[model samples]
Target: MPTSKETSKTATFGVKNIGGINSTEISISPGVTVLTGKNATNRTSFLQAIMAVMGSDRASLKADADEGHVKLDLGDETYTRTLTQAGDTVRAEGDPYLDDPEVADLFAFLLETNEARQAVARGDDLREIIMRPVDTDSIKREIRRLEERKDDIDAELSTIESRQRDLTDLEQRRNSLREEIGEKREELAAKEEEIDQSSRDIEEGRKEQEQFEQKLKELQSTRSSLESIRNKIESQEASISSLKQERNQIQNEIDELPEVPAGDRDQIDAEIDQLRSERQALNSEISNLQSLIQYNEQRLEEEDYEIAQTLAEDTEGGPSDTVTDQLLDDDEGIVCWTCGSNVDRKQIEDTVSRLQDLRRDKAQKRSELKSKIDDIKSEKRAIEEKRNRRQQATRRLEKVEAELDERDSKITALKQERKELTETVETLETEVKELESEDFEGILSLHKEANQLEFEIDSLESDLESVTQEIEEIEELVAQEDTLRDQREQVEDELADKRTKIDQIEADSVEEFNEHMDAILEILEYGNLERIWIERVEKSVREGRKKVERTKFELHIVRTTENGAAYEDTIDHLSESEREVTGLIFALAGYLVHDLHRGVPFMLLDSLEAIDSDRIATLTDYFSDYVEYLVVALLPEDAQALDDSFDRVTSI
Candidate 1:
């Protein structure tokens, strides 16, 4: 139930050309507001006007007007709805209280024709009506999407875990590389010292060895250039190999992606457009059927025989009797409003009943068509996603291949350079050997050892740099492990919610309906009615070629006999008042279960004359406790039964 704080504000409505009302404005405060009038006083029209501003397309335009408008002022927020005739349909526009009013329409509106109320009266599938707002297919699709995301996250975490296992090995390798580099640096320094000593020795022992010393210096410089060229060649070779491997991996990914057909997209789009057009046609047919049924029902219930009398008078050799007299005589039959022929009232009712059934069937078909369109749209989205992924992979593959080609060219150039450097080194060595003598042998050997030590130091430093980079990369991956696990947990939570959402709504609905039904039944005090409850029962049903188990809500009615013995009874045995109360309670259960009072603020009731005036008063009072606004249309006598403190709108 809503609190007083939630219902303290008043709402004002301005309506024009909606339902039977031409134009009117009214202000209603929170709690019970009764619309007291006889039939044809636009009581229902006022309710329709409220519905229009509340974002329901079921509101009808006035028969004489091409456009209708409604405005609702609640608190400081104002909502408006504009209805304009377009071809055979009325299009609604402008901002309203809600963007989508499906839940409110089902649970909060509470009109006589509301599906939830009518479903109980007609003994239709209660579960289907209650679960209509819940899109199981959409829920399943979301679950699948979340599951896929979780799977991807899990795979990445698995890779991260594997990298973490290599962390220790990478650290050890980094330490070893550092030590090796340090040793090589020390050896290179020692060798340089030895070369310096040898050079001093040569300078002191042989003053004429200066020309040989200059040749040896040139040889060592040439050898250093050769070593640098060889290093460049090795680096280029490694880069080319890595780029080729990347290109191959990208190529494989591209190959694995499914190919999108050239014309499939266009064909699917065309089909979807066709389906939408068909759906629109079905909507029009359903609307027309509903209007027809409503008109006929009013004719029957209100005894408005003007049209039927006119038709009967127009027929040749028509009965020279009053239409009222004809209607009162069941044997002679009443004039058929559609054809001017005399037909039984029951026959006309049977036709109307058939029309109602047809409307329901078409409504079901429309729902199915909507689902089909959604399915096709989902398929289109999947196709577009796949095409996007393929395009991205192809672009990446092209870039990698281009890079590989450039590296290959660079490698070829380096190889040529290395060859030239090698030849020059050989020539320099030969020159040094030719200039060699016994006195300079020690100096030459020291220079050779120093060059070897320098090469070894460069190699060790490169290895250390490689090992350090690997360790840093592993550490970064390890850092992402926590984030990945958090993401997986979030996805799992969402997945669980999606998977269990329908079941929870079902269980809650059943529980709410049962609890409210018991209380209302007790309050209404149906003497024979001992209890009324709903059971969630499971049964197997055939779906196309497959058999599946489904849950259904079974309504149970317990009654006491004259002998004071209680027995179970079917819904068929319930009286008119009992049925209407049950329907209203069912709607209330839906209202509470969906928490419509929190958003809708109003519950509208009409055509509830089956229940007695005292019961109507009790019912309205009981319902007023739940919502901010409870507006009910009742006769003047019924209104008298209500509390005097309740607001009464006697005129539109």
Candidate 2:
């Protein structure tokens, strides 16, 4: 190839000899230069020296005794590079002391092949080229957008599932409640029937009771008539006795009852005396019992005194009130002096109360003993009175009884008459009994009425049972309804929560996607990108078989044209030029997005040698005017053809 100088393009890089130049200093100008020399003649070494000086690549070098040094004129600044190979590594001096051992590793990346050389030699800026094709910014933005959409979809799916679950639960509860309601309705119907039957039974019982009452009245009237007959008979018999006694007494010479035999009287007197003696004994026994009871009472009083002393000693430092009052006021337990342990105030109060009960019991027993003594004395007086009455009656009875004996003979004859009358009365009583036995209408009615009442009560009981059963069913149904209502409320709450989550997800996704798209569009010099959407294929039916689905993206570009006309386009069918422009816009967008998002500052580009030279020139001018640092790989020829605007040139 001819020397690059013939093209008159400025060189992107320049070098000048410094301390390590061969006995001379040479300034490299801004133009292409050709270095022709045999291998191992310091040509490659010189290149390394220049790159090392510029703080660029240095991978191919061997250590020698001396340091190779050079100076470089990068368009903006000057750098002095010096290198000394130490075994497999080299030391470089450019910026500061690259003390990191790996600092000398630039040699590993040295351009060793034509491909590597051509890649670096191209003057096309890598940043520009990357910005030239499908914008990395747009791709990244689209990816983020899709991710956000996916998150939203996931949230929506969760909401749907939750709603479904809640709805299903509500439906199940409703079904259960309906079943319970059905049972309750059935029970209510039965209860209504039972109540009606109970009312009927009550009515029947009342009617039967009326019949029994009427029959009972008739029976009572019949019994009264029988009573009157018996009284009359008794009076008539007494009349007959009086007449018979008078006749018999007239015959007896004033017949006094033979004075009760002295022996008989004596025997009676003995019985009376014995009774009096027994009463005397009971009085003495009662007196002794009183004395014993008094002794027990005294003993109880002594016990009371002891208990009082014990209580006073035990509660000396405790509450001053009565035991019960202290218990009411003192919740914290008192210390028992006797046992040096905690004593519940309530327990002490209870003990005191028991002592009072004992006292009352002792008093009650004393009173009871006194009452018994009085009763014994009263009984003895009654016995004495009976004895006196017996003595008085003995005198009258001796005289009157004698007369009574004479009257008794008369009474015998009267009794015969009375017997005859009694026989007639017996005959009447038998007839009455026969009349009663005739199965009166009242008796028959009573039996019938009792039977009816019993039947009514039975029916009423059956109806009450049915009503109770119905009430139980209603209660169960009400419980079920309550449960269903609670479940419905819960379902509503769950659905509300799910909806909120879904809404939140949708909002978040939309915001993130918009932010990302805005960032990319700003970098591309395109107006707002409205949206990035993904379309998924679904439900393919072929050969009578349904097939699963897949998804693909359709990139949408929305921007205002240079003329201020709004335009929208799809990625499917674009001219070569349009595609290239679109790609470049996308790449620019990517870099801007990367910077915004804190990505790497450098851009590495490959394969831009296909553009025509005119197009390449325009792109170069555009890149030089726009972005920052760019590293491009290109064909050697393409590199040689770049205009004189490139900042720096280095073979790969």
Candidate 3:
């Protein structure tokens, strides 16, 4: 058996799928070979077929087929993956690609894989994923130990600083507060002197204001009573006018009611209903008579047929035999079957004639019943017309009656309102009589005096409020000045201490691990991300248990230009090719870190759609030399540019 390196030269994947693929075998032999086809011609499905045989669980078998299966044939040995029970049952034999760390890292690198796409966009995720393929457990443990030690130092410093808090500015703040207190004391004394003078002036003003207010009150009472009497007189006049107008309307309505000729509407309605009942009875009788006529006529026809059959028998038979069959029994009555004692041919014919007459009478009676039904129908129509006219007259009368009732109601309401107006007018006249005898000159003079005192009192109250607020502010400042000064000094000292500790940890083991990743990117020649690195920084909290932002480290992508090292700060600025190349470089670096060891190890990528054709060709040529088995799926145009870089190529 050859080693994996030799066996990897030519590989074939055979698949019998329950889904997109028919039974087919595809071979990828030595060097770059593109599986080219229009979309969904089993191109991607074939690639997935290879993945499935290599222990990739991403085999989407054909829908509703008995069983789906994939086989990987390396000249030395074969690996198989079968999905049974219509793809519901998955059975795999041979090693999963993930069992090999290098293979696992390569699997993670596949752009079709979710893990690779996620790691490429986020810095922390990329850092962990790239490092996953590298042997860095010892370095990681050392970094963890150092971080724990640094945390301990920081914790001890916090406890000591909290216990022995420094307040260097306290003395200065205390002296300043003393000066402020003295100034506020002088301000308070000046305000008190002004308040005392205003109090004496207000006392004299209050006594004068009281006498004026009492005089104004008595005069206002007289004015109120006069206004009320005037308002009532106006309301009463309006009421009298409205009442007269309503009474005239009621008289007009009573004079205009129209007279209608009286008719017994109920009797007409009863007659119309009776006509309808009679019509229904006529129809029922006609239907029964028609049925009887039809039945009897059918029986008459059958009897005539029987008599013709008897006549035919008589014509064929001997006369004597025929006559004997027609005769009655020996002990019969004298007028048997309407025949006399000496039975003759005429008597037999009369029996047949009587039946014919009876049938004719039945038909005549049916015709009579039909005529009666039509007459009843006509009567019903006439009665319905009369009933409609009576209904219209009744509606008109009801409308006229409703109008008369409304007019009568208005007349009664108007009379009641006129009586109320007369009473109101009498009460108003009595009230106006008493208010006609008061003097208002003295009240006018009192109002002017009260207004002047009110102005002076408002000015005094405003000044008192200002002085009271000033005193309260001065006392608060004196109380808080020392505490604020102590807090400021302590915060400044702690911030300075933290800065020193931050400087001390810059050259630690974490930075060294980052240096190794930087070298990997350089090897992969990630042009867009030359100095890309993750940074650790402190975060702020609201004095609670520490809660970090989504991640502790920030992913910084830096691009170097001629001027200096330019920064590509955000993922958005990178082009599609640049971004994909960054992920590709990471996966390749991981592949080398773990060292390739799986049988027929190869790389798979389904995401060349975003990269330009030139870049795709260049990357294809570049990757071909590094791996023995490189199977790429590309569109026709991109595969055309592949040229001699591919050993052999086939389309689906």
The candidate that wins on TM-score is 1
Q: Is candidate 2 or candidate 3 better by lDDT?
A: 3
Q: Write the per-residue lDDT of candidate 1 for residues 402-521, one digit (tens) a residue.
A: 887888888788788878878877887887788788877787888888888887877777878887898898889889989999999999999989988999999999999998888888
Residues 401-470, candidate 2, lDDT per residue (tens digit)? Answer: 5665665566566556556655654664454444432224344434334444433443444444544555
C-alpha TM-score for every candidate: 0.91, 0.22, 0.37
Worst 10 residues of 2 by lDDT: 101-110
Regarding TM-score, does 1 or 3 come out ahead?
Answer: 1
**Model 3 per-residue lDDT tens digits across residues 1-652:** 1345544446777788623677887788866778776554556666667766766654555544657787777766666778654222444445433344334424333634335453565433444444433333334434544555556555555544443332223334444555555554555455545544543454353444454334444444443444344444444455546645654654454344333223544554465566566655554543344333322322222233234344445555734554444442222211222222324434444544454345335534544444554455555555566556556555655565565566556546555654655565455434433332223223343332333333333333434454445555554554554554565455555545454432333323236435544755555565656665556655453446765543134556788787676757676676666667656655554554444423436767665877766667777766666566777877777777777656544644
Candidate 2 lDDT for residue 518: 52
CA RMSD of each candidate after superposition: 3.3, 51.4, 40.6
lDDT of 1: 0.84
Instruction: Estimate candidate 2's RMSD in Å.
Output: 51.4
Q: Backbone collision count in every prediction?
A: 0, 19, 2
Task: Please list the C-alpha lDDT of all candidates, in the order they appear.
Answer: 0.84, 0.41, 0.51
| Full-model lDDT, candidate 3 | 0.51
Please report the candidate that would top lDDT against the real structure.
Answer: 1
